[model samples]
Target: MAATEGPTVAQSSPSSTPLPPGMVLGPDGKPCRTCTDWKSWSKLAKTKKAQTQQGGSGSESAGASSSSSAGSAAAAAVVTAGAGTDDTAVNATAPDDCPPDREVLGRATWTFLHTMAAYYPEKPNEREQTMMKSLLSSFSQFYPCGHCAEHLRDEMKKEPPKVASRMELAWWMCGMHNKVNTMLGKDEFDCNKLDERWRDGPSDGRCD
Candidate 1:
């Protein structure tokens, strides 16, 4: 969800606040905890805690220092929630019945998208195709990560969803997902494996 390159919007400029590396600022110029992974959020929380305990008047960042107490509390809650367990366990473990981090949310979202594409009617009518396009348009507008949503919208404009048939839709989804993977420097999934990954069991029938 976090923009690996930079802020997503033109309106968002660098804040006076000294945010942790890779922390994303939302449109409001506030730190978007949901945008970045938990590690960055933990760094912010620790910095605030150190300042608070020392009672020092540290240099305040634009949005971070203003809401330090509330933001730090929220970050601390996420960390302490998994207390009595291994300290290393807390990182990237927000999906176990807690609010999901960006990675968890992204994976769950892609799963739903690909599954839906796999199950789309093989020979959908005009109405069905229109409905599918509409659904995707709306999804791009309101995804949890604002920057991610913006990027998807841009991609959609470049190559609109192809919902004419099940195969087309599935391949389109795969291409979109691969674009994201490339952006994040991850390996591209083999499109030939779409059915095995989303719809049918593998040739060996392990899933079955």
Candidate 2:
């Protein structure tokens, strides 16, 4: 059977507050809280003020005591959510080492998907091709960003995955990514450089 499970769609909370400009919408046309930047999700300022205790001269990051008793708990949360948000006002600004937010999460996910496509078998067998297609479909259903999943699912329906060869799938995935980047008002990557970006690195041997 095909992957049919998807996020439980719901309406966005109807409050006096309006969604921020870059807000993401779910399949049911609701504001997707998990798919939006943390900053947009709340109106409260997230930057933390430096503590001014007497004789305390170190910044938050430089402080050796930064790892409080909550370190393990925070790490576990990050492991499960793929990113951690400091809910406390005192720690609102994400630490330099903290987990990724929505934007960071999307970038990392795209990198993994593109790289995997680049390395797909040159001539996939029947089982491999079917599995690759299924993987894409299932990923669209369960992707963390609801709007992104909807967009990907719609795109997949319009143009099914091309798994005839590694190069074909790689190029197709690149084009789809560029579509997303464009919609997000970001620069579109050059499809011709897929191998260089994901597989071989640059020709300058910088990665070597």
Candidate 3:
């Protein structure tokens, strides 16, 4: 009789089975010699989980800080808006060691003067130059209103009803002065004629 063929090796199935400790099956279902040790695999998993938890905690902390910052900013704005306009009240609410009111007014006056100087057209005529100089000098002197009421009244009397309001006139003059100063500082042409046009009108004390 012919020799019987030995039993052939059975083909493994595609589905994987768990092997013993420190062993794993490859994609082909054969034992994987390169499988990581169980201890190392467990340590890696723990490290990954810990990192995820830390990341989540950090994100939460950042969100809380952002919310806190936004709340603080809003509260500050509200506080500022609630403060009244009275100079004394304003000063009291301001930070300690704030600049004196006179100093601030003086600075503002100079700023206005400088602005006017720049905006006034530089006509070669001496009258225009003199008028521009006088306007700047007047603004510099009359600002801070401590003792310049008489001079201010006189000027107001000279202006027309349409331009007489002290506050309105002051604002316009200061604005013009600021613009002139800015232009001059930037090396632009200085035109001193703008003040002359305004000065020609009858002085009315109410600008509003």
Candidate 4:
């Protein structure tokens, strides 16, 4: 009797390499055109496609949620990230803790008065004269004679007044008095009395 033949391996063509296990040669003797390992490849392709679709859908949903209400979107994002709401609450209440508006205004007024006193100088021009008068007048409103007497006295000792016009001298004196009053936080004294005592006196005696 003839010996029984085991299953024969298909011969590969000269131009083709042999297929791996679980693969077979096609009629052309190339690896099989039909996917022999198709199950895992198909599964992986499906998973990747699903992931791409899921990512696109997630982005669209996020955009829609944000458009629905900006504040709600922000709150949702914050909560989803595990942050607390205390910071927002604190920011909302911060303005209430500020100082009164009037006190701020008073401080700003005093600052302007002090700056003008330090920088303003007598100029022969009409504009300069007008500005000096205006500055002095504004100062007087905030710092009357008695309020500023001590500061005025100190200033006079530092810089004696020269022979300027009576009006010019008065303006200088008023500015000095305002400076003193603002520093001391008191009402200014009488301008007429100051003038009477110091009109013929040395420039430094205006404060005294």
The lDDT for every candidate, in the order shown, is 0.72, 0.62, 0.37, 0.39
**Global local distance difference test of model 4:** 0.39
Q: In candidate 4, which residue ranges exceed 4 Å CA deviation?
A: 1-100, 122-124, 135-208
**Candidate 2 lDDT tens digits, 1-208:** 1111244332223532233333455566665555655544432111111112211432344564455323533433332232123334223334556555466677788889999998999999999999999999999889877656777898899999999999999999988888777776778899999999999999999999
- What's the TM for model 4? 0.22
By lDDT, who's the top model here?
1
Candidate 3: deviation at residue 58, Å? 60
lDDT of 3 at 38: 29
lDDT tens digits, residues 21-126, model 1?
5567766777765576766655555545654543333236545555665554455444434331335743545537666657778888999999999999999999
Q: How do all models score by TM-score? A: 0.76, 0.64, 0.21, 0.22
RMSD of 2: 12.2
List the candidate numbers ranked by lDDT, top first.
1, 2, 4, 3
Residue pairs with colliding backbones in model 2 are none
Top candidate on TM-score is 1
lDDT tens digits, residue span 8-65, model 3: 1122223321122322333354432223222322332333344444445546576676
